[model samples]
Target: MAYLLSSERPAVAAASRNPLLAILRWAAKLRAERHQRLAFREMLEFDEARLEDLGLTRNDVLEAMGASAPQAGLHLQRRRALRSAIWLGRSSF
Candidate 1:
């Protein structure tokens, strides 16, 4: 997974130029936010096979969908940490 960090001031100013795009972006963000919450709540019960049927790996779908920077940032960090932990565990073993 890749982590993207936009320069905050420029990013906001650029987004402010297009009202319609901004609204559409907001709607997409809302949808993704809802999905993330649902995913967390149902984490144990989630099915990877079904996600593939929907034509998406969880990460691909997430990047396509949209998310607030804070939420996305937290997720990125968590994923990085988990990957690091896995590597460390393998080395220890």
Candidate 2:
């Protein structure tokens, strides 16, 4: 039957019968999430002066690591505004 030959048919049939494959996929996803969390932790360990030298604040790093998309967008806008204001102030002196 044409239904049996459809591209979508084999993958679903194979996945349902293959428990090991499902487990491997889950493990890989978990590993990637752990790696991201560890990297965020290392960034947080940096001191304030060091973070400032990188043009980032603690809040910025934390938001980038864990916040939702909307929250991150707000933070980005606020950061840009602050930088613009600071630059204007410095130039006026």
Candidate 3:
């Protein structure tokens, strides 16, 4: 029983990591699609409810897409500022 439990631990950890990796991949795909100037209708094909289950709101997706737009220079600046703050906070050890 102990040996079996130990062997299952890595599988359990990998399983837990899968959802996070999936969300990251989905986000990357969504960002790439937005950057490619995909139509809103095409973007909407991505299941919003599934993204929501991953803790991302529609607004979050919109914001990410907006920030990624080349013409949205101001939004990109704000995102850089926010990202710097986040990294700063994480580094405050």
Candidate number with greatest TM-score? 2
What is the lDDT for 31 in model 2? 86
Candidate 3 or 2, higher TM-score = 2
- Evaluated at residue 62, the lDDT of candidate 2 is 85
TM-score comparison, 1 vs 2, better candidate: 2
RMSD of every prediction: 10.6, 8.2, 14.1
Q: Candidate 2 — which pairs collide?
A: none
Which of the two candidates, 1 or 3, achieves a greater TM-score against the reference?
1
Please provide, for model 3 over 1-93, each residue's C-alpha lDDT reduced to its tens digit, 9 standing for 90 to 100: 445664465555555357788799879878876655564334456687654444444554466566545544454345455555665685332
Looking at candidate 1, what is the lDDT of residue 87?
56
Q: In model 2, state the lDDT of residue 1.
A: 41
Return model 3's CA RMSD, one decimal.
Answer: 14.1
Q: Whole-model lDDT, candidate 3?
A: 0.56
In terms of lDDT, model 1 sits at 0.58
How many backbone overlaps does candidate 2 show?
0
- Ten residues in sequence with the least summed lDDT for candidate 2: 68-77
Report the lDDT tens digits of candidate 1 across residue range 1-93.
544566444444566677898899999989877877676445424578864443334674365336564566465455555555665685331
TM-scores of all candidate predictions against the true structure: 0.40, 0.49, 0.27
